[model samples]
Target chain A: MDVYKNLDWEAVEKLKISSGSKIVLKRDLNFLRSEENISVQFLLDGEVKGSVDCHLCLDNKDIDENSRNYLYPYFTESMNILLGRLISTDPMLSALKIKLSPPKCTIYSKTIDSRLMSELVVYSLVINDFDFDVVLNLNLTVIN
Target chain B: MKEIIPLSELRILVVDDSDFSRSMILQILSEAGCQLVTETNSAEHAMKLIREKKPHIVIADIVMPEISGIELTTKINDNFDNIYVIMISSLSQEHVVLEAISSGASDFISKPVQKNQLIESIQKIAQNISKE
Candidate 1:
């Protein structure tokens, strides 16, 4: 089965959070996406890091300043949910021992890690007007 | 108020590290006519409230700071008698699910929790408790 096809995107789409609510799942790992707003990385056993970013995935850009500050966490939460749901449905991915870190608001574009074998390729999800680049920095052996 | 099987009498505690996730859960619970709902951002506070307030059901995130949902569930099972735990998280790994169920979770709801699943799980646990 195509692993990309197995990843569920329906649940996220059903959540009509507000205006301009939409999500696109890019199967091509190399799929070029836009800038980042929020990113969450899942590090598995110090080897693989599965990163999910909701670059500018906000439905209501017009939300008040106070609401906007509060809303940033929701984007992070969305990325968390996106990755969690992806792993849940896929058996192979779930079997690995992974430690999920708290979501982070990424500023700099994701770059290469020099210490060990890593990769930054996963499904880059673009929602609304924002870009969420998901990079899994791990050996390509795991990808296959 | 219209009578429903899952009444408003359920004292529930919502536990998660995310303010957004907590608010979202509270909104859904309130919409379902839940009267007494408490929100906490982490497992430690949730444990304290579970002791003081003694909620019937706990909707918690599996991955949390300090202690994980699995650890919390184990503690609750070992100490509490009638508390029902429904672990909700963005990560739905098989081991996480297994550990949650083994630790004493009544149900495991994957994050981005759906309304139907949330209601059904709560009601099912309620119904089972009533049967006993």
Candidate 2:
């Protein structure tokens, strides 16, 4: 089945917790070609491990600098905060001493509406497992 | 036939990844009577500027890309005997605080830094430097 052909962009957009938040539901045309998968996981309040995987597609021929600059910092800071929160809450995980294995970012380009669209893939992880029940909520704030 | 001031003139270098934070610190230092203030967005740039300008005090953010404030302070202390380093950070992590002190930071201040708090920290640095 062609997942990209039936992708509900609206539903994916609705799942976004913040204006800059990236959420991926399934693999797309881009994921199949790159042979890579992006995932971000956060453990909240000593339990409740949650993760998201992202797959992006772009034409790869024409990409712009503005889009790359805009996306890079946004993703980096959000992931840092998410990971920091997880580390702070989980004492057991802190003892296990998991550390971020440096972030990997890739850029690609695609032609959409006769214009080049740039896509970025960022993968991050946060690990924490405890017995307590917890709820996870994502919040993004504008830095001034 | 010259007037002597109670507080010596200070040349301060403020380093932070955030432009907003650097500007806030600069404004606070300026108001506190610091005559020369230099600002940099990263610790590497800050070290280069520090070597060139030879500022009396360096106020740096603890967490940054590439080199961190602690690393910067350690490098400065290794080469420069007279300069003072004050670390400013939003993080109050115990490990971070201990690392900053161990790395030769003269003091650490928590962020959302108020004008008075900044002035006090600088004053403390100035006084300590004068004693040494």
Best-fitting candidate, scored by TM-score: 1
Cα lDDT for residue B108, candidate 2: 83
- Residues B1-132 of candidate 1 have per-residue lDDT tens digits of 433435488889998998878887887888899888998998889889999998889998888878888888888888899999999877777777787889899899877777778988998877655421
What is candidate 2's local distance difference test score? 0.52
Q: What is the TM-score of each candidate against the true structure?
A: 0.72, 0.51
| lDDT digits (tens) for residues B50-95 of candidate 2 | 8799888899887676787888999999988888888976544556
- A5 Cα displacement, candidate 2 (Å): 36
TM-score, predicted candidate 1 vs. hidden true structure = 0.72
**Candidate 1 overall lDDT versus native:** 0.65
lDDT of 2 by residue, A67-134 (tens): 54544434433444434433433343333222232223334332222122223222222112111111
Candidate 1's docking class is: medium
Candidate 2: docking tier: incorrect
Question: What's the distance in Å from true for residue A95, model 1?
Answer: 3.6
Candidate 1, residues A1-144, lDDT tens digits: the string is 233434344433333332343234545534443332334544433223444433442332345667557546756676677666655554555655565666656544443332332333344344466544444333212332
